[model samples]
Target: MSSWFEERRADKVADAEEQRRTRAFEAELRREERRKDRDEERADKAQARRDKALRKQARAARREKTLTPGNVYRKGTLLLVAMSALAAIPAQVAYFVKKSLMLLPVPFALEGAAWVMAAGVAYADERKLPAWVRWLLRAFCLSAAGFAARINYIHGSEQGALVGWGLAAVTMLGPLYFEVRQWVITLSAAISNPRQQAEERARRKHDRRRRRHHRDVAKVADRLVSAAPYGTLKPEEAWARAWAIVHGTTEPGMTPRMHAWAVKSAAALATAQQPLPLDSKTIRTRIEGRLHASAFVLPTASGTPLGMTKSAQVVTDLPPASKTREKTPVKPARRQPPAHRRSKGDALPFHPIAKTVAADTARKVTAVNGHH
Candidate 1:
């Protein structure tokens, strides 16, 4: 009985030890398999990276080969694209550089450049630009001009833009007109047949009618001048009546000089009793009488409320108001207050004539220095 119990205990101990050993071996095998998986993954990633690098190198080499001068003909489209980009690059750089130097907005300057470039391309290739391009560029230019012109006209300021645009139109359109005349002659030659001649004559007639319609605008100047009450007024008063007449209905995007002309025409006719807007002859006569007693509206072009300066408009940062106390710009020693007594009870020490002379002198000096 003792031997049988001993044998059974030994057998149980051996079985338990075997089971522990088996479990340890299985865990070790799993660890080895996991390590192999990590190594394989690392190897695969390195291989992929090498392959990608090689592919990139191959692509770069291919591009370089195709872009060589000898290969240019085979890559005509690419050549044009590159040329276009190259053409645009200088303008792009110039625009941004100008903006950085406080010249113009980058976007606006670039857009202007794009427009010029487009025009150049069309002219060089001898292709008429798409209508949309012209329309878009015109829209951009007009929008900028309209806002600036409106504000400048209303404020009766902007020495440059007003003058610049007017002068520019004169200079540019002068040559353009002659060229157009030549072009017209060429075009007319192509249509010398009787039927075509008739069409041309009708077109000319239509153009004439349109121009006449615009030209026959009321001579406001005559009305204001002859309106007796306003017409006979002092310069200040006359100017007011003239201004009122101009403002009443003359904002048809014409020059202020044109506005003055219209006012003068209207005034000349007014004494003969033309009906004014919303006012009876009696009311008009009364206002004119009052105006005549005071200063005549001196028909100064820039003196008009909505007058555009016919000069080159320069970009300047004007203060909101120049009413604050400031130091003397030249002397730098005098502290100028609001009530600066340059003249008796005149408020400020600002002399427009003096400033203008100084500015002109300075400009001339600078120009002379540049020549030197």
Candidate 2:
């Protein structure tokens, strides 16, 4: 019985040991699988890096092949692009050199060289240059002139300095003078442009109507004076009243000087014609009495006045004195602020001459009514 128990225990121990060894073998297999996966991942990464480098090199080679001068006709645009970049190299070099120089901060030496290079870029038969290059050259040339002016001001007498600076300026900017000479030609062409001439002609055509209208207005004024009866006032005063009656308002748009001109023109024409036999003083006195009786309504020109009104009538056609008279209730005049209350720059309520004229007219009117 003891031997049977011992054999069972030994069998159990061997089975347990076998299970532990199987677990260790599986763990080893899993570790080997993980290592293989890591190696594959690393190899793939290395291959991808090599492929990327190869692609970059190939692209660079293709770019270089396209830029070769022999293939210029085949890659015309590409060649131009390459040349444009090459053209820029000089300016960039100059700028760096200018920056490196501690003696001059203004960079005039590089600027002059750049200006000359600009002309080469402009007129060179090498069709590789772009339109933008012309503008870049122009900017460089403009700055070069300022440097030349500065050199002239500071060291014009130094032939050595002049030669060095001036040579750079000549190389860069000398050709720009040719472009400047075109200004006179361009201006002349603009002045003589067919389109501009046509516009000027159209403008002149419109002026004719304005001139005719002015002439017609002057004629109307002269006719008014000729029709008017003689009065106590001067010919100029009588004409002014007649003009107001004919036009209804003062001459439209006429300056004071222009109004004076129209009056003189009308008076000249009227004096040349026949005069009426009416007594001037008696006519004036009657006109004054009638004026006091009612408010006067100046007549407007009959038939198409300034093309604004279709039908009009003369002042004589106004309603009779008794019929036109109004018994309107008087409203109080606007009360003006007293002189002491007025602001510093305020105008007076009445002008001195106007006050005197009102007083004289009132006295005359009172005397006339008494006589009547």
Candidate 3:
């Protein structure tokens, strides 16, 4: 019986220890799951923060790009014009409503006419219509506005002095504001920058001067421009071609005849300035003549005359005439005829000095050969 009790107690202790280990394992698994959930939540929060920062940066960049001075002015002016129109309509409606139900259309028509004409002015600017058309639209807009203002003034005057002025002011302000905006848009479109305006002015002035100076060429250019297909030929190109045709030269301010005259004059001046060529024989003859002339003395008060000097008389240390003999002149070797003689058309032209230099070189070669 004692052995039986001891075995039962051992079994009970093993079961309790197993149950405790199982419970501890379950608790560890739950802690791991909670840790995983906390990590996922942190990651989500980080991603959300990054996305929000990116959106904020994008919004700022968009605003920076969109907000410009011109955009602000244009959009603000339109808003103001809209506000003016809204404010002025109530006054007109109130005045016209008391007169007659049929006359309710009159106030709308008056206000509508002014706004329509104002819009017409903007349309004219967009279509690049004539200045007079824009001015006409402006006039119509002002006329309608003026008529509306008169009606408003008359109607409000029956109420009070301050009310009359206030109604008239609001009635006129819409059209006037829109007209000024249209003017601004037109001027901005026509002249974007002061520098561009000045450049356009200068270009026009230069074109006028050129046309005045070259009337004939200008007429020909104009004719050519008129004859060509529209937008096919530029005025400058036409002018260039016409100048070439009229002057017979591609270069402006010069003609073929003028160029020929200039060349001829230059050649003549060069020839006039050039020294004459001297042959070897002429050079020797001139030297000998100078020596002979120096030997003679002119008759002075204390000296003998040149004609009375004798050949035999030893005037100084000069050698006797009998001992001196004239040097035999060496003739240059004759150049062989070329197999094919070049004609004037085939020959290349050279400077005039080249021929004189060739002759001198031949004479020198001959003289050297004779001495050798």
Candidate 4:
């Protein structure tokens, strides 16, 4: 009986173990399904984010393409800050003249036109056109209406209206001349700066001279200095030899015993070379100057003076022409009478303001002849 009971207990234990394994397996499968669903969700989100970013970038690019210089994009960009405070007086005069329109029928008509145009724009405010276009159109229409109203007012009143309107126009627009002058000055400064122009001119001159120098120097001497035949030599010796050949001078390896190195060293000691910077702005500015100087016009077969070709081989043979001298005639010196041996003719008496200049001259001549 004990053996049978033990067998039953083992079977029960086996059955419980089987049920636990089944539950664990189902849980694992359910967890895998949840993970798979999560991964799919993440992928979908990433795709959606990419699509959104692409759309935004496209919109920004489209906006940029619509920008134009003559439009409102450039209108308020003008800097007139320097014309402040001091210009307020004129602004006040403008305001006063604008206000005084009530005193004159012609001025009143212009003011009425302004109000009508403003009302027109106000009524159309709900229209969804671009803000810049609206502002530009309104400015144009308003200016036109004001002009027409002014003309019509003058036509109606005849001779008297003509005089009063002309006077009023001058008074009203008089301050605008200063405003125009300020605009002119601002535009001039914004367009080109004098300091920048001067610097550019200087840079162009330097580049032209430097380019020619480089072109000349690019053709090194037929033979570089060699220390093989001679003793140990410095780099200066090499430069000296090259310089002599280029300059068409016999000074190379000549007396005063200038080691090619010493001459080069002395020169290096005397002059200073500024370092070329890596910044792009500086480089661009320098390039602009060089282009402006290009008009100075170098004589070259190649479009660019720096270009090298077969003709460069015979470059030494074609030395640059030296400036010519013209023989100028020498003028002879004029002989002058001695101050001690004064002639009555040479000395004229001073006269008072009351004496007519012509009479004074005649008297002086008579006095001189009498004394002689």
**Number of the predicted model whose TM-score against the real structure is largest:** 3
lDDT of 3 by residue, 1-372 (tens): 999999999888999999999899999999999999999999999999999999999999888766777777788888887887787777888888887777788888988999999999999999989999989989999999999888888888989988888888988888888888888878888787889899999999999999999899999999999999999999989998999989988887887888999999999999999986555666656544654555434443336443424442222322235666559885775995555543555422332443555565676657755753
Ranked by lDDT from best down, the candidates are: 3, 2, 4, 1
Q: Note the Cα lDDT for every prediction shown.
A: 0.50, 0.54, 0.80, 0.51
lDDT minimum window of 10 residues, candidate 1: 307-316
Candidate 4, 242: how far from true, in Å? 90
Candidate 1 segments exceeding 4 Å error: 73-372
**lDDT digits (tens) for residues 1-372 of candidate 4:** 999999999999999999999999999999999999999999999989999999998988776654544333233322232232133223233444565755345434444444454444434444544667546646754574446434434443455876546434543342233234434544555547788888888998975674466444323532343423554554455556566666655564343345576898888877756455545455446554654444322234545443233342222214456597548875774885443544454332322321343454555556545643
TM-score of each: 0.21, 0.22, 0.56, 0.24
Query: In model 4, which regions exceed 4 Å deviation?
Result: 68-372
| TM-score pick, better of 1 and 4 | 4
Alpha carbon deviation, residue 177, candidate 3 (Å): 1.2
lDDT of 1 by residue, 1-372 (tens): 999989999999999999999999999999999999999999999999999999999999999997786355435533443453344334334444554766436435433543354344335333455757645654554444344333223223235556445433332332233233334444555566979788889998975674465433334434545676753645434434444565554344365677789899899889678754432444446544653454322222234432122221221122346677777565554664453224454222323443554465556556545743
TM-score, candidate 4, is 0.24
Checking candidate 4 for backbone clashes, the offending pairs are 236-260, 236-261, 237-260, 237-261
Tell me how far the alpha carbon of residue 239 in candidate 3 is from the true structure, in angstroms, after superposition.
2.0
As a TM-score, model 3 comes out at 0.56
Model 2 pairs whose backbones collide: 115-172, 116-171, 116-172
Backbone clash count, each prediction separately: 62, 3, 0, 4
Give candidate 3's error at residue 127 in angstroms.
2.6
Write down the lDDT that model 1 would get. 0.50
